[model samples]
Target: MTTQVQSGGMVNTTLMGGGALLVVGLGLALANLMTGGHASFNSGSDGVTWGLPVVNYVFFALTSTGLTLVASLALTFGNKAFYPIAKRCVFLSLITLVAGFASLALELGHPFRMLFAVPLNFQVNSPLNWMGVFYAVFLVLGVLKFMKLHASDWDSDTSKQVGLAALVTECLAGGMLGMAFGAMAMRPMWYGTLVPLYFLLTAACTGGAFALLMTYLTYGSESAMPEKVRALVQGPLPAALAAVLGFTILVMGYQTVIGLWSNADGMQVWDHIVSTPWFWIEAGALVAAFYLLVSRSSLMVAAMLIILGLFINRYEFVIGGQLVPLFKGTWVAGMISYTPSITEWMLTVMAFGIVLAGWAFGEKAFNLSDAPKE
Candidate 1:
């Protein structure tokens, strides 16, 4: 949902709206648990195990990592122009990571068991295992960095050092998660070096777009942006967004051509994607968002579209990747049909609800509207 702001005030209506969303989301999540969430997976014979919760997890997690990187531009790299926006970015990064973790907890069969097992047992060979480790590190570092940022000695050297550590850890965590998918030889659509590279690029782009949208929504479109925030938005952010979007388009095109030509099972997964309406929606949104981005016209619209496109991109990739029948015995018509159950939808809603509630909390607790001068 697009944020609403008026006359330098974030609308109370919007806050109420977010609250409403949270209530509905949480209610559905509770209902889902009562109904036995993942038990429904056995009803389908398809190999597609990951569903809406995973999609929600990927979307929030990628944005969180990207938002952290944006914060580091000012916090770690000492970019004065980016400083005004750093606090908001850092705060959002933390909230989104928390939201992602919540999704992970709900997705797991035994949530508490995962909490103990992930740290106690180390799997050196598994990217997913490494992903969990790094995710935990990122969360710890992020909280420390956020605290240091809001502290009285925020500008001190120690704060900067913590910021740097947070930045490095966040990048590593994001890369490892990308590698988790890229390393999946069983999933042809996500395999190889390209997927990881594409993941990072999209993360950066999503972060930039999200920051811009949040800043605009925070300050209200009618109000003037602070000079520093405006500079950062106009300067490096646009460049990063354009470069990443362009490169991703190129990568996608290459992947598509190779998939069609190679005729290999992994590459041929593109054929299934081509037939899906979701794929077209994802592609169209990306192209339209890119056009809006480069033109610098209707930026709020562009940022919203970009974020939507990224969300859809993650959704399609997660779902479409598993659509091709990996096991012929369980598949119907060479593909598994998956329409996320009501429970799955509820879990996704809950993930977003966490984000909305987190923002509301930050607005009050952290004074999210005001960026203090150094």
Candidate 2:
């Protein structure tokens, strides 16, 4: 059973679980997509749809950037402590990046055009354009790096040099994603320039935690992040990451508070985020993450808290961004905002399923469980 688990059994399980989830999720998402577009979801009201779907995409994309960098750095930088956990992390990034794009495609009216014709059709300064270009560059660099790593016998030194440059580019692209949204004055809640900085920090925290979790689960105990690996990731990494997350939360909350005190609409949305159940939920996860990190618990406990904390942060970023309505010169509460329709939920589930399926299958099929001997 253990041999099979290390070989084909895991793949079979993932395919069964993730594959089924994907089919149902995508089916529902598609149905929702067909109905929502070509007409206002709000019945002639001109308001941007803000809710779970878009937030989910952002969470996935941002995480992709962080995960990619974390993985690539370990592989290429000769960081032995970090190396056992780097493999498949980049593959995971690529998978989730596709998921992000998939969610965004469902949300847009002309999703297909955004890939090609939209650039020629639209202007340069649009935030979407910046995001498009950044995503484009990351996508291209990702492919190039993948090819170089997998194509032929690139020696360790060469691979490291090339990987460093490519991953660095990916990081810049990832930071732009946050900057693009946060800089949008149209949404004052998102207008802080530090948004990029905030997002980048969270990405690292979550990405590290994710890598740690996968290391334990995918490989046996031998594959579990060793003391050295944990020291490297959860220690200095989290210590620094926590500072940054704390900073962003402080800055973000401060901005929200100031915005509310000064403006009517700001206050309404601020009230919603601060006073609602969601607010407490987000805060609780974040606080717990800190609790684990700061406390002298088992490394497993600390890593789990950090990972869950980051996940909760992702959820809040998605939902909170949309919770505050930027309408009527004053925000309104009591209106339950967008929930992922069943289809929307399914598509997301499917995307997740596909990733798990791929990861599990790859581990069995291709020896993804083994770290790069490089």
Candidate 3:
């Protein structure tokens, strides 16, 4: 009998879906906490302690960095096309940033220590320690920027200054994240100063792709998108996306070739990775994203593929880094295997759920529409 959907029905639907994800996520988290931290998980050995949590953390954190930087650039440049989505981008950044921290929390031996100890205890030399500090600063700046944009006019000089501050802090946070792992020379795959720079570029690509997708979803129709919005998505986004993809492909290809050629214990992990089904999935999604962007096909499809590819990349980066057991010089009998515990899967769902809830709430509360009414 109730065939007609009410106004804001879609938002309600998203809210409900997000709520379900949150419940499942929280329930599993509580269960894991009570049971004492992923005891059921098979992390292979001491060589592979980190798993899905690290992957999820890196994936969300990188995306957060991307969104914060993109939104700030939009504000700083005063590009009318990019202006409309700045607030949304900032809000999404905050959401993903918090989610990233949550994922990391789950991975920790004592998750509660993150709240106070992270701030009070200073490991000045550790990149990971510095990363936590940078993340906190980035979070504060994001919240400040979001509040400014939400409560005041977008054109205010104060907002621009806040945006700039947020941008600088985001770069610091993102760079520290990459360096946290890259500084580990023992893990040859992750080593190098170039890693931070690579993260910055990829963050741009991720942010651009994500913003484009959100634009398509929120605007409803092509006519709904302002001329400037169209230019932002169809112009800069595609070009940037293509270029970033090209660079990523080149780097990854070089890594793969060198890994195979070396056939050392560390590099030998690539042999196992290349043979896995996920490798093709990651490659296919990346190729599809590139093709869609270069061809100027469906921006939505391209965005989806890009996000998927990036997520898979995070998984491979984190997991593959530890697959080959580093037992002095002797090779292990078999490859280290890891399958995410149920709790890990639930937390991953919870992370995306938080993103959905934030997006829906932002749309509902801020009237995040492109209709030119506000």
Candidate 4:
């Protein structure tokens, strides 16, 4: 009883703290809008037009998609191990996607206009347009699926069907998100078919990591976890994570090697990228994360490391692509520099604040444990 009370108190404290951060972030975002819009951001006409907020958007968006995909293993594929926490994954997916939208809202000059423009002005050739549509569908399907899961006590054919639909939509959305960058022929660094596959791979990694982290947090320790959940986390989950991390490492390594060997103007940015301390930090984090997973040292630590590495990886990908000025030698001299402003950082805080609060609320309101069999 004492332990339960302590846990409740901790959750309440987290909720309040997250709420405060959200309020502060929103205040800063409003201040930014009033004070000349994009001027507060570090982006300029010549370089890095898509800055930190964009990175945050991509990070949260892909994480949400990944969560949906991972949840499908239980809901759609009938993976018994995942059944215990599948609902929580769905909940997190919805919250993270909303947080992503919030970041995007702050990034855009007039976010409200998009609500009207996107639906009214259909651009068939636009990957972004299709991406938006798919995500919107995903959000709707996810909500319906969650509702059905709760209504049917977490086991029903209807919920499974919806989960499958959500999974498909999430895949389409994630792929289109990558295509949004890959299709830009002008951005030579980003112009490739691999980008979409890379996005999906990293998405799976993040999703799995998040699931593991949440499981540990919810249960407190392996000993505290139910036998079924413990078995899943100890055996299958870690094995899957290790495999994905290995693939990610291979892809990233090859990307670096190929970039160095190429003489393309945009590929030259890899030379600069490899020299940066951040790049090494990103690589080190992933390698360390992989080691932790493989050696079965600490799943929580590995998850944290993977999340951090992925954030840095996304940051480098977005910023590095724009570093090499499009009109090199003619207008720009060398690589462009970018540092996210205070406003952008605060907005990131806001997104995390939302996640923290949402998770706490979900824990408080819902029974996240394995559903009782009918």
Identify the candidate with maximal TM-score. Answer: 4
Of candidates 3 and 1, the better by lDDT: 3
Tens digits of lDDT, candidate 3, 227-319 = 666666778767767888878867767777877788554767888878988878878988888888888788788888888878877888788
Off by over 4 Å in 3: 1-10, 221-227, 328-332, 369-374
Structure candidate 4, residue pairs in collision: none
lDDT per residue for candidate 2 within 1-374, as digits (tens), equals 00112542335666678777777877766666676653322212223355545666777777777777677656666555555445557666776677777877766767776667875777766666776676666776665555554443234566666567657765776677777777777766566777787777777766665565555455434344345444555555556446655664565567556756867443355665666576666566666756655553444455566655555555555455555555633344433355445655665686676666666665655444344443
User: Which candidate number would show the highest lDDT if scored against the true structure?
Assistant: 4
lDDT of 1 by residue, 94-157 (tens): 8888888887787777999877786788779887887777778878878887887667445688
**Model 1 alpha-carbon drift over 4 Å, by segment:** 1-7, 40-45, 222-224, 369-374
**Candidate 3 colliding pairs:** 81-228
CA shift of 67, model 3, Å: 0.7
lDDT (Cα, 0-100) at 61 in candidate 2: 79
lDDT of each: 0.73, 0.60, 0.75, 0.83
TM-score, per-candidate, Cα-based: 0.91, 0.79, 0.90, 0.94
Candidate 2 weakest ten by summed lDDT: 1-10
Ranking by TM-score: 4, 1, 3, 2
